[model samples]
Target: MGRGQLLGREDGAAVFSSRTIAVAPGDDRVELGFRFSGTEVVVPDDARVVTNGAVVFGSVDCGAACAGTGTGPEITVDTSGAFGSVDVRTVTEAAADRADGDDD
Candidate 1:
């Protein structure tokens, strides 16, 4: 993937046999069924974690007290048939602007 992008299965599986992959933002919609991953996944730092389960954002060393239904832009981690925790993060203003293609 690109410098600031991450792509993989909901359960964090390799999409291709190659270690290098390239993807860009798109307007496409993807529909799936009971998604589950057996591994940890990485998502955009600014994306919010929306789920009824636990969420670890900002730091991996945090405890259960840090688990929360996150704020900001929504990134649904829970689906109709799946419910679990996710580790997320925050992004710097400059990085967020870059992700939005705002170089100024």
Candidate 2:
């Protein structure tokens, strides 16, 4: 189909979302990218990854090192339903500069 249909968003320690995405019917892929770090990922329950290349997942981690596409697309998130992204970016404040460096 066209670009993935992004639906809803809910926020918490991690963000929750719903997106209606799909590859062409009969076709098994969509040109998409996924990257996460020190975080969690929640794929839609109804989604499928056809023709698994080097993709793997488990109860807690996305296996493989740190690449999305390798010789070819490593993983393809096939969907006609919703999925979620884990927003693990924490907000922090910059440290205040000491008066030592101030000319005033």
Candidate 3:
């Protein structure tokens, strides 16, 4: 969410505004969808994204192939147990994916 911006909680979900780093509690089976437009999202070394649903990617990480100022906005889905059953990580190319693109 934006700096100090409160998205306000409703039900059991917390929404975050774009353009800043934020962390919120997540369901065990969290669904992750990411679209940076012209920006990039980084997955920290310790981040674990898993699910029992459908997965199109074996794994993905924000490598040099993704360009950023290293301080862009981020949303961290952190949770476990019944609330952290499944997690989805979705990423659509703002630009085209390259066959030679370097990803970590």
Candidate 4:
């Protein structure tokens, strides 16, 4: 048996081990952005519960909302928290191209 090895001589018995990572303050940041059709939303604050580039919650926040650029629908969330999970879905090409690139 090695120093890092687990010894289990019984049935249906198991042992597990894990390592932890420590992050310093202002060391991590999260940016979430999305584009839709003809509108956009961009939040440049690097904090939790941020709105209009302002820090509504959490520390290490931004003073103002980031100015949005470019066309089309979009939403952006800039945060200083960890992103444990995310889910995304988009329309199919057939539905998106129904207007033949024409805006009326």
Best by lDDT: 1
Off by over 4 Å in 4: 1-65, 78-104
Each prediction's TM-score versus the true structure: 0.27, 0.20, 0.21, 0.16
Q: Largest TM-score belongs to which candidate?
A: 1
Residues 1-104, model 1: lDDT tens digits: 11223343554332222121122233111121222322222333334433333323211221221245334344433222232222222334334545889532
Across 1-104, the per-residue lDDT of candidate 4 in tens digits comes to: 11111112242111122111111233222233222111112121332222222222222222222223323223333422221212211122223333477221
Please give me the total number of clashing residue pairs in predicted model 3.
10
* C-alpha local distance difference test of each model: 0.30, 0.25, 0.28, 0.24
- Model 1: runs farther than 4 Å from truth? 1-37, 52-72, 79-104
> Looking at candidate 3, what is the lDDT of residue 63?
40
All models, RMSD in angstroms: 11.4, 16.7, 11.8, 19.9
How far off is residue 33 in model 4, in Å? 14
Give the candidate order by descending TM-score.
Answer: 1, 3, 2, 4
**Total clashing residue pairs per candidate?**
1, 0, 10, 8
Report how far residue 103 has shifted in candidate 3, in Å: 26
